[model samples]
Target: MRDTLDNLYTLDTLATFTPGVFYQFLMTKTQQFRFVKLGERFSSICGLPVAALLHDASLLFNCMTAEQRDELICDILHSSQHLTEFYGCIALTKPDGKQIWLEARSSPEAMPDGDIVWTGFVYDVTAREQALAQLAKSSELSRTILDNMLDSVVSINEQGIVIYANQTALSLFGYQAEELVGKNVSCLMGAHHASQHDQYLQHYANTKEQRIIGSNRVVQAKHKDNSLIPVELRICELDNAHGRSYLGVMRDLSHKLMQQQAIDQLTLQDALTALPNRTALNRRINQCIDNLALNPTQYCLICLDADDFKLINEGYGFEHGDEFLRQCARVLSDFGLYFLARTGEDEFAVLLETSEGRPSLEQQLGLIVQALAKPQQVFGDLISCNFTAGAFCFSTADFTYSDVVRSAELALHYAKSGGKGRIAFYDHRLDQHQRQHALLDQYLRTPDILSQFYLVYQPQYDVAGHLLGFEALMRWRHQEQAIAPDVFIPLAERNGAIFMLGKWLLQQACQFIRQAQKIPALAHCRVSLNISARQFASAHFTDEVLTEIRRSGITHSLLHLELTERLLLENPKDVVAKMQLLNRCGITFSLDDFGTGYSSLAYLKQLPLHELKIDKSFVRDLPVNSSDRSIVSAILLMAGGLDLEVIAEGVETELHRQSLQQLGCRRFQGYLYGQPMRAEHWLQH
Candidate 1:
């Protein structure tokens, strides 16, 4: 009975508490209780014999300190108000130098008398607490990173419904978090993609792919204001414990696109003319050429160069030159049949579309020339200028667009060499001539060819076969070959060699006239020297001519400056004013090549002139063509009314001379009297 009672008390009371804590408490208080009889009594009351239980108090003491064992017993006993009602026992102890958290529950068969309890279980909760702490830390880190991201982050399910959105995502779409939480992703994309959204989704589903996933893609998205906004998007797929989802990181590209457009505009525009520069022009021309290759139609490439443009810039100023270029661009744009581009500082190019198989580029060239002839006002001074243009038509199988441009450029060179403000069409012969002219231009700059130039005097006769005056003409006696005035004069003008040449001719003409004035037979005779348009347009032209007249010690009236009608037409009012000013200083003027220009009679009447010379074309056909006869009669009648003397040029036949004398023309010039001779020979004649 004693053994059984001891066992009952031991089993019942001890099992109600955690075995580790209980045993630890017993080891610390071993002197307080003699174990066998009490344990047997406790076990019998708990319904288990004492021999059935095992107690290792010494080993329990090795696992915990005395203070730990004491604190465990105090908490268990003090927890009677709560733990005692639900659990038979609750224990706490320090094991492995840390707090050991444990709980135990006992069977409900205990009595009020000091009886033992039984049927309790215990568990360690430290591993579970550590796991929960780690999980909470990971969750906080993820939330922090998502909130601070710069790019808008959005998540959607397979149904295209928005499951999650970060702050940036909500702000970018102009929606509040609550407003967008359950909305479809297509709501932000607006109607543009809404109609086709199902198709896109189907495509993706069929291919099991996404175009933007894991890469940057440009796309359009809708804002809260229902405007489409360009955006760069990067999408990624995510698989987690919850489910599969997609993440889209979007960046607005509106400002970036605007900047790119600005850059492109600057790169393609000419800084001076504000037109498409060479880079842009080439690109457009190439594109047009490629298109034409597929269609094979005739096209025209027109190349234009401002004649004597550098002289204007250097003589006037860069500001005035820039104004001139601007006006040129404006006039070219008015043509309205082609696109104009500035190919160089003073060069422009035009591309035109022509009707298939039409060879009517001449009309277009005429229109261009007419347009450029309009007068322009620059820097409080009215100035008129003209351009030389060349055109090539791609009408045959051998010609390409590039060939057309090249040919057009070559033709432009020819037109400039022939005379500026003229149009030349592309021909195979002209190409060879252009190449030779280019070589001549390079070699003709030497001083030998330049200094060897001389003047020949042609005798001018009155109606009674009396010599009036000698007209001075220039000739170049090259070392190897004789260069005609027609050839070398233009080359010299283009190469800027004409200025020096003109000065030399002016001095020689003045000296010769002074010497002729000394001859008793030629006492009243005057000498006429032909002045080029380039020389007349010089800034120092008036001063140089006046100084040469003064140095010759000859009367200014004895020196006559002959200028072509075309020169006066270039800035008519200005030329009239300049000529009138020079005339005031005793210089004389002659309108050379009359009836060849488009100037009105009113314009010609305004010019200060002493003589009008009928052009060679009219005089050459005077004996045959009735129209030429009528034109000559009309011009002589008009000059008679204006009190202007009429000089018939190219009077090569006796009929032309006799007919001109009968028409009341006082002056006659040409080989009929005598061809141009050396200055010494003219003195003897």
Candidate 2:
């Protein structure tokens, strides 16, 4: 008995220290339930006393809800009936509001006394359950993040079969989630790449070489509709417990590519005429030059300019002019030219293959000329579409694209000069003219260009040969060779060197007239300096002229500014204003080269003036040409009526003087009286 008592005490002490509660439950055949042995830890888990549970084993289930209590009873009854093991899990909240999960399992036995017994253990399983719940929540959060991304995400297994696809991936490839899950990833690739995918994977597996991993590339992806879509794909290799897999992130490049194509189209096309622009023409010429090596065919570059296109702008409006140009473009397009482009305002270029061996180049050129010269109705007016063209033919690739275009443009320039509405072909003389122009342009760019040039004075006299002042003529001597005024003057104006040249001329002429005060023959004489259209149009022209006159300390009345009829073609209001301002300051103005340009009595009456010079053309034939005599007579009569003085240029004989003298001409300037000479020689004369 003492040994039995000691054994029970030892078992009780072991049960008290164990991590779980040890218990014995019994169910009699009469449906009565009781706990024969209960551990003290039971009270700690269920918040009840072991003594109470011992009295009525039902108290052990009091902490559970009604549903849980019923389930526990059913489990116990089934175990008792079948003499099988019983297992159950239930959640309960103690009186102190501490919640816990308990798990119990027991083996059941049927006793000979018609009662069922269970020996079981109950454990607190709250920590393990909470950890499992947290893991599931974390997985759901990761899934949400992947599904909501902007870029498509896809994961494939080692066999290249898709194992996972995000919402973006499904939408990007136009596939449902289930439809793409187990399919080979190559199904979404083009045939070329699809056939090579497995090889890529096998190569990577064998050699561990990264051919495309961790890199971005643009590729074509097959859509569900069997159409190709451009996409930027990036891939990475992943290593996890599930073995090797690949992750691909793709971005759709369709919209971006379309926008780039649009921008490129705008770059090569003209907006107004809807034709290829200069850049496109240059590219076409380069292509022709490149192809010449293989085919050795002759090609011609024709540059065309619409003659008097500006008349449309001035007569109607710029809108009507634009319509006119568009019509011209349509007309040119109808000719089936090889390549056509709009090179500038009212300028078009064509590239033609001359080796077709048909109706010769001249015949083709004539056809084009006739077609363009036909009048077209524009905004209710029959406007002529007359165009002048210049062409250059070549069979070799010896010239650059710009060189060819420049040659054609040079021909066009000569054509326009010869007479508008004609076609001109390139020649060696045109090439020489271009070279000379280039050399003169280089000289004009020099800083000391003013030093290379000097001025000579041509004496102006009355009919009796009494001297009036002198006209300053600019002369340039380079390498002891004289360059004509018509050659370098236009070049200087084009290159913007005229500004510097004009200022220098004003200073030199002012200083000379100031120095001429010592000579009795020229003490009160006025020196006339011709002004270019560009110089006269300067915003600071008045200021520059006044500043030079003030610096020279010469009377403004002793300075005479000669202006060509071209000067009046610009903003006449500004011209009249400037002329009136200078005239108010005692500076005289004269219309040089009268009756040669588009000037009328309206410009003459509006502009503040003091004199008119008959151009040498109307005076060179003097007493012989009836038309020249009539024009000169009319000019003298008009100048007299306007209270203006007249100077006749290019007089070389007494007959010239006598004719002018009879026609009421007082001023005569030519070799007949005195020729252009150096200032020192003129002072001596």
Candidate 3:
């Protein structure tokens, strides 16, 4: 201990000694340092210039790091009895150069004058430090493995504190390495998960539950700002020399979720209007029915369709029809309907919530009808919606959802059959209407209905009371009632039964001419048969007529085919050619209902027409209705210019006949001339 205290001498005592040519400085019997080594390497490593050290060796003593110098003193002062030696490593810098480690030793040097100085030995250990650095660079592969991983890599010690985090983990949680290291790993979890994380670790430590060790899990992770995000998590047990720790990998799922949502939108939406498609609407119906168990929500399923939409589709191409539907979707969307969809080619459906305080279902339907009344201008064509809607209301009482929708469909058919352009609510009476359609379908398919079909003729006469011919009118006498010609005729046309009925009518007309040929009074008279537009357009029409003529052996001149002006105007070139072909073979065509159709004089001269029959509507009110007089005068003058023979029908009074005669109509047919009668009754007359 005396030697140790003697080696720690002050700078003043070292100054009193003579400066030595040998590499040595002195120290007193105190723990104060003064460099005695004057070698260039020792002076440089001790961080003092050669001149500064020579001028005052204490400069080298002050240049030593505080930690290294204090450690040296502590080692000397705490030594055992009689031990003054000390040896250890210390670090220092020369000027602003790099740190250089030193292996230094000092011992007491007792002089004869009772002053003492330390004999110090110091050397540079920079090579040893560099070898340690090279050892660390050799393990760089481990760092590269962690950095290149897509999943975030995190390591937590047995105490649940984070000890290591890779670049991916730093980026995933939005934190720097220093900010995350040493913090509890639970900081990376949501609050709910964080609360239980400690318990999880404790249980795993005690019970060794390996539930999370090797399995992947979907979980939420907290970012640095505490916002939670979804992540796919995987954890593995890591056992190493330091202690127990955990390594976790996490992958983000935000972009994947966004892509799935985009795909779902495309699947469930209409391509044009972005409305829910038929599939989604079907799902929505079931969902609404499920909600009915809780609330008393009154709902209605409505079926609506455009009237005469086929006409529009044919008039303007289908592309325009598609644009019309898209526009209709826009209009219906603005109604705030509970649901809407384009359910058919030109039909739509809407689900409405008829809750209390809202408008009644009827009123809501009326509002839509009124809105449809406004013309929809599309592609410079002003088109009115002209829609017919049918609704079936339902509450919780309805058991099956599909049945209610079917009931609405039945109501829609009833609305259209009752003369469309109206809304019809589902009532019990519509059940009877459905039955009747079924019955009609059965009747049309059966062969027995043909026997009940027959024709009656209404005679045509000139003003002089001479018989010209008779118009053949077909009628159906049903088992229960006499069905109106207007009702049964459209039914036959709609069901494709018109073609058969038309052929039968022509045969009967030709048979009548054959029978009437037996009587001299009816031999040369003509027979006018009204032809349906469907039948007139048939390719077998001219053949049917000539075949009937040869079968009955009646002159083809006696059979006159009556067709409407509108039918003549449709495909005028075709109709004209067909009429001219038959007209050349002694068959004549009479233009039926002349003024009521497309009555332009441009097509008047083009048709091979033998007569023009003024519509009965104009003939009903004759002389007193001067408007009818003016209309009749115009028709007569146009017919005169075109050399078309004009005949007036519905002549119920002598005044009508006289008035028609004054308008230059020489032929007339109505009850005034003769009521429709059997060919036998006509022959007897």
Off by over 4 Å in 3: 1-268, 282-298, 306-324, 355-388, 394-396, 399-403, 410-431, 621-630, 653-664
CA displacement after TM-score superposition, residue 359 of candidate 2 (Å): 11
Candidate 2: Cα lDDT at 255: 51
TM-score of 2: 0.59
Question: Model 1: residues >4 Å from true position, as ranges?
Answer: 1-281, 284-404, 409-425, 436-449, 479-484, 487-495, 517-520, 537-543, 555-557, 567-587, 598-608
lDDT of 2 by residue, 1-685 (tens): 3433443345455555544566668889898999977777778777878898899776657777899889988988987664556777678777677778876766564443577766656767665344324433442224565676556778788899998888878998999999999999999999999999999999999999987997778899999888998987878777655677887877666754543344334435677787987767877887888888788899999999989888889988998888888988998899998999988889999889878543488688878888888888987888886889998887898877768988888889989988888888888799898899899999999988888999899888886767789899999998799999999889989999989989888998998888897788788889999998998899999999999999989999999999998888877888999999999999999999999988989768877889999998888787889999899999999998899999988888888889888999999889987788888887774
Error (Å) of candidate 1 at residue 555 is 4.6
Top TM-score prediction, candidate number: 2
Which digits, one per residue and each the tens of the lDDT, describe model 1 over residues 1-685?
Answer: 3433443445445434422222112111123311222223333223333444344333333444677667654544443212221232222333334544343332211112322222223334333233224333442214345555555667777677788777877778898888897888887775867767667766776897766567767788888878888887767666656665666667566644543343334435566677876545555665666677678666677888888888888888988988988888888887785577887788888888778333467776778877776778888877667888987776444643346667888889778877979998789998787776676777677766657777898888888888888889888766567767777777878998888888999999999988888788787778888888888888798889888888889988888889887787787766877798889988888888889876578877787889998999998878878898999999999998888998988989999987777777788999999899887886774
Cα deviation of 417, candidate 3, in Å: 6.1
Candidate achieving higher lDDT, 2 or 3: 2
True lDDT of residue 108, candidate 3: 41
**Which candidate achieves the best lDDT against the true structure?**
2
What TM-score, computed on C-alpha atoms, does each candidate reach? 0.47, 0.59, 0.56
* Alpha carbon deviation, residue 610, candidate 2 (Å): 2.8
